[model samples]
Target chain A: MPRISKSDVVNSTLAFITLILFWFLGFWLSHYIALPAALLGLLLLFMGLLCLGRVPKPLEYVSQFCLRHLSLFFIPPLVAAWFYAEQLGNNLWLFLFAIMFSTFISLYLTSWLGQRFFGHSNQSVSQDDES
Target chain B: MTKVNTVDWQSIIQLVSIEQLLWITITLFAYGLAIWIYKYFAHNILFHPIVVGAILIGCIGVVSATPLQDYLIFVRPINWMLGPVTVALAIPLYQQIRLIYAAGSKGLLVIIIGGCVAPLLAIGWLFLFDFSDPVKLSVLTKSITTPLAVDTTNIIGGIPELAAGVVVITGILGVMFSKIIFKLTRCDDSRAQGLALGTVSHAIGTARAHQIGAKTGAFSTMALCVNGILTAIVLPLVFMLFG
Candidate 1:
């Protein structure tokens, strides 16, 4: 049987602890540290990533784990948005217009430009690779 | 004297109720549990634990009437992770430095033009519809990630919170349709796909770009970082000069 690595234990433990810390931090910040909470959250996130990098050959697995379940973490915020539904309702037209217009515009431009710039580079790289 | 000593526990208990602490613990444990489950069955795309967990939490919040704000207080820490996740893209980015450099001034020119044109077109369309200034500004920031979009919205006199909502909506829509759009446009090249997505749709676009392959994802990540900074700087100045 393969020995259970110390790094594996540490990575799993850290990921678990960070999730809880993030929640408590969010809760505390909503009441006590709105802006600071956001700042601190960003800070902790970077720290967590750094910790993730220190883990072994299974780093990809760890990242996949986070990505797969990342949306679960945002539920609280969505719920918070719901609580403010009345405010959202009052500004429905503005919100609708903003979301719709921005979505189309952003998607179109990003895709189009990304294609243009990267296409040029890819052509050059492939030519080099073939040679 | 003994009676006097026993008189004041109720107020203390009320100050920090066991029930509230229990609720907080439960919510945190749920997040941890969700992560574990997602890890267990990581192959299925639709069953993405994050989405599943979000839906579950949202349902629970609705049933409990636990003010979203109260839950936000507990969940805000997750948002904090956004910064690191974003910056970490720099790692993949560093590996692609050669490709970026080789693209050179020509590549820079293309990116700048595309970035500028995309937002202009978006804002122009909104203007045609006679949307309010706040709405227009919010739309302008939608092509970037939520954090940057929120900040850009504020600088340009739009509501940051409103920008956040727009960013989420924009990401979902972008992710859903961008591939179809790419196919329709006959854009089969990875680099072009990445840039177009990153420049126009922002993070969601980048995510879509990644789905195509590593080359596309790398370029999209680059586009996201560059476009984010460019728009943040340029949008405010454009508004100042023109608006």
Candidate 2:
């Protein structure tokens, strides 16, 4: 009984087409151009969004969509790692050490510095609440 | 005349086989259709179309015995665009200059500490565990986004492609879980949230932070840019020293 909003149709269609178009464009650029496809994909995304107007809700929906499903995009690449399994197999110990070690280090350092820089000292609290 | 022409007709027919052409067309059409279907069902979660399409393509590649490298040749064109897109991130950094200025020395200090510390921690931990050179190099760049991570890895004598993989994984994990970690730790302020997300997750984390609030996004963007530059300079130097 309700009429379809023109804006909704346009936005949804744009959203749907943009992803495929960008994917193909990224593939084409990566193959022919000397640039990385992810960078180009992002550039086209920004430009496309700009041209699509400042409709906050649709844009928000699109971004949320991207965030939630970020992992799906990388599945192909991850599976590609299977092809290199032989090489990785030989270097299994090294890979394990690297992933574990680096993850811990990044986690610790970020948490520590994050605490120090943004950490709430008594002075910061008093200064803020004093005003 | 027919008998004379028949002598070469076989070779001509083989050169333009309908079956082979039809197969190629079908593959291309299938890929397009899969992507379209993925986009339609994304529904703003882990089911996003790009992710689904990637999974489908990957499964197809495995099932068909297609060499991942050959498929990459097709995907590489899209992958190459990562550079300019990174440069474009600078626009947001420029826009947030006023906030950066407002936070002033304190903000600069926070960025500096985060930028310098994150890579150091990753590299140092890898070394302590005695990881191989390539793996070490890959992990060193994990705190950044894919494009920059690849470039940084290449410059630092690591495998760029491998680095890209690590960067993607790191980003996914960071984006998905950092918020829960933050909430658990009771880090509720925008500044702290931005710093934590940016420091641990990199660009994707920053995108997540942006969703929380403007200040958080601004700070997260700053963290991404500053950390990127710092890691670019510092990681290579550290690698030279220990690597």
Candidate 3:
């Protein structure tokens, strides 16, 4: 396990504040337009980084940390499953079937489409074996 | 278990409610434990941390008769911070774009098709079965990331909570059967494999893609972002015109 050092704390704090600024800015902008605040913030950050031509070290550290544990954030809304109990119970099999069926269809469709669009490029095939 | 229940959970909730920090710590600890279980139990995707943690929290809520709103309140900070976290996603998104300049519009085309196809198929399937409009709308948002799902659901009059739940299930199902799908289809291109996972499965699929390899992770990240942004922007407009 890698222990977080003092510098780690400082860097994450800085990264966090930067993200919050973007988040706030996005929220403010979303009032004028009709985009999701987070999406707005994300685009702003991306464009800002594009201008910089590189990710800042602190931002990189924070983003990696957040993405690694992204699943944690989803758990709260997932508790809504309890609220979904009544509807899910009545259509349990149908619900599962629809979700799984649609997922598989989408999954295979994308995979096949990916093949059609990207599969022919043998030069980039080097990525296949390395993974 | 009976003795555990003997303690007045109501009073405990009241006491803990006074100091929000206590509940937040407990919530994080539950999620951490869920991850530990996933790590120790042969790493089965079946016992996904999201699933297990939700179950644990549900149990606590049910046993105490705490409403979902209260639990949400207790853990509100986590939800509040999601804004910055979601914004932070752009770093990885931007970085991946730079890494895979060769993919370019070809990659975007694949993602757009996949993103649109998955949701349309889901909505059509729901219509065939005569599932309610809200369920159909929620399912339409299922293939996107959770945050985007919430936003899209809100736009289309779907239940955001249900949309979030459906998104998780979709992602898990994506990770669950990806290997079989890959083998049956013989999709050997890393870009293709990653794009399929990211576009169809969203963030969860991207996580699985990362486990496959660095190149795959890069492509998957690109697919996740492009597919999400496109879906978020285009779906609402389509609904306005046709819904």
Q: Indicate the worst ten consecutive residues by lDDT in candidate 2 chain B.
A: B43-52
Q: Please tell me which predicted candidate would have the highest DockQ against the true structure.
A: 3
Deviation in angstroms for A9 in model 3? 2.4
- Tens-place lDDT per residue, model 2, A1-111, is 967699887985675455556656754775664344544454565566557544345444454454333343344445454454457775666654454455444544454
Winning candidate number (TM-score): 3
Using TM-score as the measure, what is the rank order of every candidate, best first? 3, 1, 2
Name the weakest run of 10 consecutive residues (lDDT summed) in model 1 chain B.
Answer: B84-93
| Cα lDDT tens digits for candidate 2, B34-69 | 556746765333543334555666677678777767
User: Which scores better on DockQ, 1 or 2?
Assistant: 1
**DockQ for each of the predicted structures, in order?**
0.23, 0.16, 0.57
TM-score of chain B of each: 0.71, 0.73, 0.87
Off by over 4 Å in 3: A1-7, A125-131, B1-16
**Which order, best to worst by lDDT?**
3, 2, 1
Record all residue pairs in model 3 with backbone atoms less than 3 Å apart, i.e. clashing.
Answer: none
Please give, for residues B1-243, the per-residue lDDT of candidate 3 as tens digits. 454447777887776566377657767888999999999986678888899999988887788788887778788788888888888889878777654567877777788888877777777777777577787788887788888778778887888888898899999999988899887778888888999999989898988888888778888888888888878877777887897
Better of 1 and 3 by lDDT: 3
Candidate 1 residue lDDT tens string, A29-50? 5365323233334335445655
Candidate 1 whole-model C-alpha lDDT, 0 to 1: 0.57
